[model samples]
Target: MKAKERRNNIKNLLINSSNPIKGQELAEKLGVTRQVIVKDIALLRAEGKKIIATPEGYLVTKNQENLITKIIAVSHNVEDIQDELETVIKFGGIVKDVVVEHSVYGEIKAMIMIKSLYDVHNFMKKINKGKGEPLLVLTGGIHLHTICADNDEIMDNILSELKNKKYLIY
Candidate 1:
């Protein structure tokens, strides 16, 4: 296939996939190397495709009609981090990212990319084993998470639960 045709096919496949498309998978489909696939993705991005490369893989933003995203402010004891994320996930919200107010760096943001209990557990375990200290403990358990859902009601339900537990800020 020609370069332009391959690039277009890659873009279309990514745009339709609900999950991340790995470079290897894309290359296998195109009969090319993963390096070529990566370059094609870069070229597609330069052409204004909103492709997000993540640890899992690359995903096109799925901006469907019912998509709703919001940043929820939450406060908790550092030890309750798992409980907080579990609550969010149980209520159907994907914890996409975390943001914290820094003393010198202004607002600092990190992608949590947590969508399930397993992800939360693995993340905490890695932190415990690799890091000197958990980052959440530095902020007194006060943080913001960007969550996404299919409707406003899911977020409302999650926020209501947060408020009930005194975790919601305003």
Candidate 2:
């Protein structure tokens, strides 16, 4: 395929992807190296594509009407993280990202990619196995999570549950 055609194809792939598309996959489809695909994505972004780079891959944001995002402050012991995530999902919210204030790095954000209890459990397990500390613990059990939902009612319910569980800091 010509370079222009390849770039166009990559754009189409990214636009249709609900989640991040791996560079390797793109490269394989275009008979090029992953680096080339990365460059192509960069060029596409430079041309005004709303693509978000994530740890897992690159994803194009969905153009939906009435998309709302809010950050909720939450706190919990290591053991309660799962419960917190479950509550968020139960209330129809996606725990989009986690933010922590680092002493030297300032505020650090990580994409959690959690929308279900299964994701929560696996994330906790990985952290446990790695013996890594939660960012909230570093900040004295205070952390913020960016969440997305259809409306404010979901957030209200999540806040209520977090409060009941003593996960919401005063």
Candidate 3:
């Protein structure tokens, strides 16, 4: 298929799917390398597509009318990453992204899109296998997460849980 045609197919697939689609799967369907799919995703994003790359795969952002977003500041050792995530998910919060403040770069952020325990497990596995430092390492475990939930009560519960676990910065 032509590049434009392939990209259009990818967009349609993402739009119609409820879950993120892996690049390898897309590549297999299109008879191209995973790298090509990645490039196509980038190109699509460059053209203003709302393609979000999560640990699970690529997904188009959904518009949920009642969803509320909040930025929470957290501080903890790397070992507590799982616990922190679980606390949020347990309180019906979806982790949207992680943001860290860098002395040189000011602020850096990455999409996490962790909504369930399964996503947490996969994210932890990817981190361990790559052995790469998390963005929180830049600031002594101090980072921010943008969390989404159904209402303010859920966000408050998530904050309370993190505070009880000594993970909330304030």
State which candidate has the highest lDDT.
Answer: 3
Residue 85, model 2: lDDT of 87
> Could you give candidate 3's per-residue lDDT for residues 49-136 as a string of tens digits?
9999976789998885579988989999889999999999988889999999898988899899988998999889978887578888
Q: How many residue pairs collide in each prediction?
A: 0, 1, 0
Q: What RMSD does each model have against the real structure?
A: 3.6, 2.8, 2.0
lDDT score for residue 109 of model 2: 88
Which one wins by lDDT: 1 or 2? 1
Return the candidate ranking by TM-score, descending.
Answer: 3, 2, 1
- Pick the winner on lDDT between candidates 1 and 3: 3
lDDT tens per residue, model 1, 1-170 = 99999998998898788777889999999999999998998998898887877556788866533668888888888677777788888987888887888787788787666778877887678666765455556688788988887778888888888788888898
Ten-residue segment with the worst summed lDDT in candidate 3? 61-70
Q: Following a full C-alpha superposition, what root-mean-square deviation does model 2 have from the true structure? A: 2.8
Q: How much lDDT does candidate 2 score?
A: 0.79
CA lDDT, every model vs. true structure: 0.80, 0.79, 0.91
Clashing pairs in 3: none
Q: Give the distance in Å from residue 116's predicted Cα in candidate 2 to where it truly belongs.
A: 3.2
